[model samples]
Target: MADFDEPLCGCLQDMFSCLIVFCVPCGGICIQAYSVDKATSSGMVCPFLWSCCLGCIGSAVNRGQIRQKYHIEGSFIMDCLISCFCGCCAATQEYREVMNRERPK
Candidate 1:
């Protein structure tokens, strides 16, 4: 997974460098960039020391637990029923069509 700072840095460079260096830093829902802060912004220097800093923070919040709400039977024949809603055919197209037709009008 690429980080988010690379594209931003590339953009800044392109905007300042007469739009010469084109950097497409994003691929499949992620982007990365490198940024620096100093007494003098070296736009150039690798001239100075290039420092790469990366970090990730993730958190998970649980919504209270609920019991599995399915009728499970111990027979293979019944397994098929559970898989397909106990033999009740899902009228996917009909349902969608009715929902669409009933909208507003």
Candidate 2:
């Protein structure tokens, strides 16, 4: 499986996403969830609530979904760890991955 286009440590590379995550992590996550499935309100709200109540699990699940969609190489355990410790960074990384991959080159 291919790796994510942007590494987790590269979160700071995108100043806009980095600042969004740093200032309002849940909003960052909400943006990601919305991007993934724009048609569904649950897709947006569920992850936002999850991040609010269970930071690691919510973001981990969201990360897993992104990984699955892009066929990126990673595991839920690692996602949980990253989300648990580096929630903002992870969110920013996820945002960058989606934006980079989906945008036309």
Candidate 3:
């Protein structure tokens, strides 16, 4: 059960993240999809295509992949539920995870 390094609400602490979460047509979600693409070794265009094609399911799959990579505790069902219900929040959390991990600590 790998724990998230940052709080889910950590995005709220960052101006850009806040914008991403609040932005109606989220560019943040795209950024997160790109991030996941890199992390999963998926094609650069895959996430974008998924976002355009599958919408919430794309981001949910991305989140599931990320969780798998990090050994985080979650299931696909949960990912779908979260992504379906709170996509912005889920994207914000995923974006924070990607950004925080990439930064030099």
1-105 in candidate 1: lDDT tens per residue?
A: 211212212233334221222233221001111111111133323311211111110000000000011121133333333223411111121122223333485
Give me the runs in candidate 3 sitting further than 4 Å from their true place: 41-43
lDDT of 2 by residue, 1-105 (tens): 998778778976888877766676366676666645532224576767766677689778888888888898999999899888887778778878777777778
Candidate 3's residue-wise lDDT over 1-65, tens digit each? Answer: 98767666566766776785587575756766766865677865777677667877877788888
State each model's CA lDDT, in order.
Answer: 0.19, 0.75, 0.73
Assess the local accuracy of residue 74 in candidate 1 as a C-alpha lDDT between 0 and 100: 33
Model 1 spans with C-alpha error above 4 angstroms: 1-90
Q: What is the TM-score of each candidate against the true structure?
A: 0.15, 0.82, 0.81
> Which candidate should be chosen as best, given lDDT against the real structure?
2
Q: State the displacement of the C-alpha of residue 80, model 3, in Å, after optimal TM-score superposition.
A: 0.4
Name the top TM-score candidate: 2
Error in Å for residue 42 of model 2: 7.1
